[model samples]
Target chain A: MKKFLSALGGVILLASSSYAVNKENTGCGLGYMIFKEQEGLVYELLAVTTNGTFGNQTFGITFGTLECKKPEKIANRKLEIFVAENMDELAQDIARGNGIYLETLADLMNIPEEERPQFFSKLQKNFDKIFSSENVTSADIIDAIVSL
Target chain B: MVLLHFKDGKSLIDDPSFFLSPEGKKNPYKELQATIRAINRNPYLRCKFPARAFFIEKFLKINLPKVKCPELDKFLEEIKGEKISLIFADYYINSPASMFGHTFLRIYDREKNVYSFIVNYAAQVNDTNALIYAFKGLFGFYKGYYYISPYYQKIKEYVGIEGRDLWEYELKVDREMLLLLKLHLWELKDKYSHYYFFHKNCSSEILYLLGILKPNNSPHVRTPWVIPIDTIRAVLDKNLVRKINYYPSLLTQLRYLSKHLKDDDVEKVINWAFDKSELPKNGSAFLYEFAAQYVKFLYYSKDIDRRKYIKKYLYALKLRSKGGKINYSIKPEGYPHVSHRSQRFSITYGFNKVTQYMDVSYRPAYHDLLDPPQGYKKNGEIVFSEISLRFLPKLHRFTIQDWKILRIISLEPMYSFYRPISWKVDFGFHEFLNDRGEKRKFLSITSGFGFSIGEKITSFSLGEIKVMHNFDGEMPIAVGLRIGLLKQGKIFSFISSISSGKYLKEFNEKYFFDYSLRFAFHINRSLSVRFKTNYQLVGNKASFEPSVSALIYF
Candidate 1:
């Protein structure tokens, strides 16, 4: 019961923690706002950067002022960019139902070991359609597993 | 035992001071022996500090007691997974605390899959603003503690949000060492350490906790400043990291994906993510994935409330779910580890106005526009404490040419999507040839705002305003305009600019026109050769110099 509770807490933490910290000047926050041509976003980034600009006191830490960086704001479920990019690798890992690459994918897919073999076996069955066709995505694979 | 904290150990406690404080005469080792006795008396304490208990047992030649909680046992059992990894989250420029990057440990459980737990040591701060947190961090005003968190939560923070690449270096420690390291961590779990940004930082604490694997003598932490990358280098020197892997941040992935898509496709992806009513297009995995990531970025970074954006977020998720997985990964040209240390020193030999001279320049820290861009932004540069001294053979004297106290420039090239103004601000002193052709040193303050566009062979144009306070002239302020092209090629790079400026005040209405063509070659990562030709016209009397120089970086 404690294990189950801890597991559930992980989910809640992942979701809530994503929106919790308000860090200024995610290099991409400014760049993305500018790139998206959103003036409102630019003002917000400026306001945040201005408010938090004076805190750095070390010579080593001060180096970050030169370049832009990404901000800390993400949803609970992360995208499987690696798996999505390497479908063949994903297929091979899934066929085996266990490996380094598959470990991360199964985690993102929220599939436990007991259910992984069967669910990933179905994924193994659709390997060609998934890899050869440009239309199919990791999300589609997730969709198939959802149906299963 | 005398309780001498190794203040010599750069704030890392290793001696009796680890056990006894300044009031050691009466209460020496009181807390330390109490913890030991508590573990023997209470079974729960044994479970909490199992490795520490083992250490105590071996040290005293007595078997330590054991008590186990099913919950704690379950956690240990789960952690006996495939690997132990040290995750390095590279610097995020916007966050003051993580400007030097951050390091944490992860226990991967293969059986439980992604349910791995992340162990982190950081200054516990109540301040939400990064600046205030940094202020607190720099002054050793915060209490540092180790806490257990979900691995995915860290992944979301580092990989999803910050767009900083994640480097996971797996440590191949034996089960015993791993247990001891973890047990040591548990023993120190909530204990407060005076967290200093320089010496007593995250990296040093982690290394100190894993003391068995690390060398007994400390690395350069003997000095007041300790950088994170330097610690990683020390770890490498000691051969601690067994295997390393890279994980691209979501922003990096997005940038890579956007590069592959057509302009129309990228526009469609952005629009599709923003518009909830819009139906999915032809279900290409790449487009759907791009759209999905765009919406995620918006949901995280935008001001829209969670409830309001959840619909768009789920819509994009559903759109992405409609497609099958496509295979590809973003390959950034460089990673954090490959970059040079922030401090730089250089020696150069060149000729100025028919005078042969050798110059030595030292920049106490950081990247500059002209520096090699392998591991830095191509157009962004900032430098401080840069002092250059020139020794002229003709004059048989060493003269200080320029000592830039601080300088920052952002060369934002206009793009179709973004049009940010390029700007520069420099506070420094330089030796300039006056109207009489006399070399006079002046304090120069120059700043400018301009529009710069293009890359590789860049078209850089700027109109700068200069204040020469110590100039031997009537008017010290000069306004100038310069337009030029900067070409950066593999074998060679050069910048050619033409500028004309007039003194604003009563000084002999002197107008100076100048043009310079400079070129450089990359001999290697740490060395370069440069040649320059200058044409200067000061009220019709013109002079030019052709000079060559070789620079060596250490």
Candidate 2:
């Protein structure tokens, strides 16, 4: 009975996991989140050209996460992606106690306009708590915000 | 038939096997008939040319037999494209390929807006050497291919890493147009074309893609070269764009963020960025944020590796998360299409020491330092194939004063947290006085590297090297320094420069000096008046020349 219940619990956990965090390197923190996997020489060369060349054949498959059917799942996934993509800019905006990226984050979180000031201040005050450690992932930061 | 790639009454497709008729490559009517026959006979050809099939079916009022194209269906299903947008990436001055700018299309997915797909056409270039790349790109030696990549990938590449602003012009595309676009893109998959840098480039290819939507009212480039911004203008002219959005680059954001910082705070941020000092304990959120952005800039410029970048970057973010949020917004700059035309023509009437002459000059492309700075890079000048011819009625002679094949100058001013080098290069035939004090023409190449400071009215000093041929039938080399001041204003502009070189000719070394001043008064975007004076001294002999000119840009 214990083994069956534990397996059921594992299934539930897997089902509840957002598609955004399902990537291979999701837990790898800001470094992996922002900088894509080193695509080696071809990527480097394509980047150098400024005008991108044909390097990746599989183009539209990776966007499945953005198409989550559940509203809450979509919100959570969008928040995570935005935070991961704009972490550097968001960090500065959060530290300074204000910025466009921060405003965008507040909007993504559905924080009311009147409450945004308090929310921004709260995030600013809990900066250390949210970031927590050097290797903190976007999921971790989101978890920290949720707890707050 | 309309979907055929036709140029000057001939098909642009190089492969003759693509056509079923013997003369289908040259004859569009034959190709059309062959296409109809092939599609009727074979279901696979309908799948191969879905767009052409759609057009033929709609025009002929006949239903073609359906065939399963799982790959094409899968692509269309995955993209779920509901809208199309023209994305123009602003010029990145550091790269020659992108100096004019770049354009591509973005397919906005209906369900997943953020994860859209971008259709890009670019030359397949493997050469790292700039000269070879230029040669191949200019002569259509490289094969160009269309690429479909995630929109975020391009955003990261252009906005995050390359520090180029993106202007998105969401086009007015409907369901039919979107389907047509996708079918056309499906047809182009794995196809190749000869890439021409100046004409059949990224922008022109995008224009062709857009042409599928409105065949009768397609945007066209009348210019000799297909500039990316010109394509944007053409689209705008057609009233195809519905909305516009601006995404500023990382560098632009950093600059806007640091606008309110004091000198000491900026220094502290710079210090923190370089790891020379620790983050201040009592620093404002702005200070911490500025430091983080500066570090990011460093990372993007490849000054710091990924490991170090993450560490420094995260630490700053952690500190920043402690502060209260401040409200800020970045205002968009002038649109690039509002800038004056690239090609310029001027006529000058002036007198020198010996004779009076009327000089006519023409510049084939690009902005000069004294040109209006409305939509161009400030203090930057790029001139190509600028030739000046002087006519002297008294001497009954017409002489080629100078022919500047290419000239580029980037006078990026120094800043506290961001420092960029100022540089210039010129190659062409120049008129100069030989040792005998006789007028002579020399093939010259000159390069300079140095620093510039200030804005509005800026000053620069550069270490210069000049190599000239046919100087007394011998190649002479000179090494020296040049200093200049430039002032760019809306209605008036001024520039002055002084150069001193130590010339090494055969067994003799001589000192030479040149001084020049120019002033321009702008009447409008297309018209300007200019006055210039030049003084040269060689071995105690001096010559003075002055001129007044009227300029028109088209």
Best by TM-score: 2
Model 1 chain B lDDT-worst window of ten? B1-10
- What's the TM-score of each model vs. the native? 0.66, 0.84
Clashing pairs in 2: A95-B320, A96-B285, A97-B324, A97-B325, A97-B326, A98-B325, A98-B326, A124-B322, A124-B323, A127-B321
After superposition, which runs of candidate 1 have C-alpha atoms over 4 Å from their true positions?
A1-148, B1-52, B58-82, B94-100, B110-115, B119-148, B207-211, B216-224, B271-280, B299-309, B351-356, B382-384, B392-400, B405-518, B532-549
Taken in order, the candidates have interface RMSDs of 20.2, 22.4
Interface RMSD of 2: 22.4
Q: Which ranges of candidate 2 are over 4 A from the true structure?
A: A1-29, A32-131, A136-148, B15-24, B109-114, B395-397, B471-473, B506-508
Chain B TM-score, all predictions listed: 0.75, 0.95
Residue-level lDDT tens digits of model 1 in B423-541: 66666777655676655676666777687888667787778876665634432566788887876554677778898887674335578888999887876656777788888766656
TM-score of chain B of 2: 0.95
